[model samples]
Target: MAGLDFEPALAAALTRHVQGITSVGKLTRLSGGASQETFAFDAHTASGTLPLILRRAPGGSRDGGSGQGTALATEARAITAARACGVKAPEVVYVLTPQDGVGDGYVMERVEGETLARKILRDKEFDAVRPKLAYQCGQAMAQIHQADASQVPELRLVTGPQQLAEYYERYRAYDLPKPVFEMAFAWLKPRIKEPKRTVMVHGDFRHGNIMISPKTGLAAVLDWEIVHRGDPLEDLSWICINAWRFGVTGKVVGGFGDVPEMLAGYRDAGGDAYTVEDVRTWEVMGSLKWGIMCMGMYEVFRTGYDRSVERAAIGRRSSENEIDLVNLLIG
Candidate 1:
């Protein structure tokens, strides 16, 4: 603590609200938030040193990558609602205001788990839990879908057409052409008919965004920035997208479980009913959406807002979705 720059301001603020926090230690930035900044640290108190995360949107910065997602306040609300529906999630401890000096964001009780896509897919430690992931994902998504928007009026409702247009506009901003995107857009523009139904969706609820424990299959669902009201099946499709499979493409449901087990779990958890055909349509849309999102990150980096190698790297991976689109649509 003597040799390094210690975090006092945040520590002091946390101490006041965190109750009996004798010391706050090791304020290490874990990674960047999807639409903000994320940090991991310890709060030393009478009980023990508590591991927690700070997700901040940096006062005046544009919500990082894209403005499509919810603000920190809405994200906190979504997490609260998800927890109420019995979904495993980080308990939001505080939502910092302009006065907190830590910027606009929130602090949450960190749940320790492996969220790395490859580790969960290949690690032997997760061998047992791997088999049950898809089912668990289904059951959890049901609970997430139940988090009604009426209670959390901060969330914006987005229809299928609206979402498609939003992504299309982002893709256009890139000003680069991908024949695959064009083909996928053409095929989907007509067929992707939404029934005007809406539900709370964990927009980026997939392998990388979800945390899993080796002993328990799923630990906590993280990243609610993109939480919105949309088609319930969108969550299912997002999970099944090939980009999330992390090399185990044979198993469609996040490269660990089959679709049948997932759907069965969904049914048992009282999720909305859907057919294979319904998922097929959404999968194509999901694939394109992921591609567009990758481009959005690239745009952020390319525009000189935030220079990160990871963001630049992701821009190239959009081609992966291109191939997936071709296989799903024309093939």
Candidate 2:
């Protein structure tokens, strides 16, 4: 019932496009993912009942402007580019423009697999799949980074060092008291330099954003809203963040593969120039970035854009995890 009433308009729109649409069945919103709204629905066309997913921007806008349309289009474009690069991503079926009357959303194949972060790491049934995850993650990221940024011109919106600076600026804009992050920024500012190579970086690469099957190593990588051109190491470091190790901090690298193994896989695939020092810098940056981002999430909830207790708790924990990273780096 989460999104049932909100979807009749979409069903009507789809009926106009696809012939012989008989009925649009129940539409239920899936939990998790704070930035966007996701729904699973059954489409009963003349042919058969088709399972589909609908993704729309949060509250249909950002920054007091109706630009979710553009973001949705960008997501579609990014998914296409990722698929072309041999990265496992859901196939985009339709992109709804503002004029299309869907309020900026897209329909894609509903990928079947486990996407829960902790389950992917701790589920014994996934033990075989888990060990290969880091390697697959490295390989998939290498492929994603290898993608020509020009293929998706929207990625030109942000570059490497600017991206880092932008993240910091975003935190400052939040106007939260973040002394730990302030220190992290001070430590990271001087080291912010252009990458040796600019490649397609998955801005939010981590175990939680990935999907894996117990029978298969990796099913697909979800969430393309943050795709951009930047240092490939950003993706590597984001994956290895201690927060994502699923209670296996000592294992690192998503608590499955070692750092050397991941780097070796990446390097073997022509992803040279990424060194331990480079990854360390990004790792530190990732911790800082996630911590600030968590604060932003709290702001969203406070502003009534969302009211989930989970968001509130996550925001509160951001500083603790960030402080842990600070201790790791400086202690």
Predictions in order: lDDT: 0.82, 0.75
Q: Model 1's lDDT to the true fold?
A: 0.82
Candidate 2 accuracy as TM-score: 0.85
| Tens-digit lDDT track of model 1 for 132-194 | 999999999989988867878867778777788887887887899888988888877887777
- Give every collision pair in model 2: none
> What stretches of model 2 exceed 4 Å from their correct place?
1-9, 12-24, 31-35, 44-49, 58-70, 171-179, 298-312
TM-score of 1: 0.90
- Which window of 10 residues has the lowest lDDT sum in candidate 1? 58-67
Best by lDDT: 1
Separate clash counts for every candidate: 0, 0
Q: What tens-digit string does per-residue lDDT give for candidate 2 at 1-331?
A: 4435557677777776656666677787875354577888888876688888888766444312132223667767877887887889888867776655557678887888887877877778998777777777777888888776787786654545786788887888888867778887778888867777888877777776788889988788888867777777788888887888877877778877778778877876667656777777878888887788788879878988889998788789887657666775777
Residue 92 in candidate 2 has what lDDT? 80
| TM-score of each model, in listed order | 0.90, 0.85
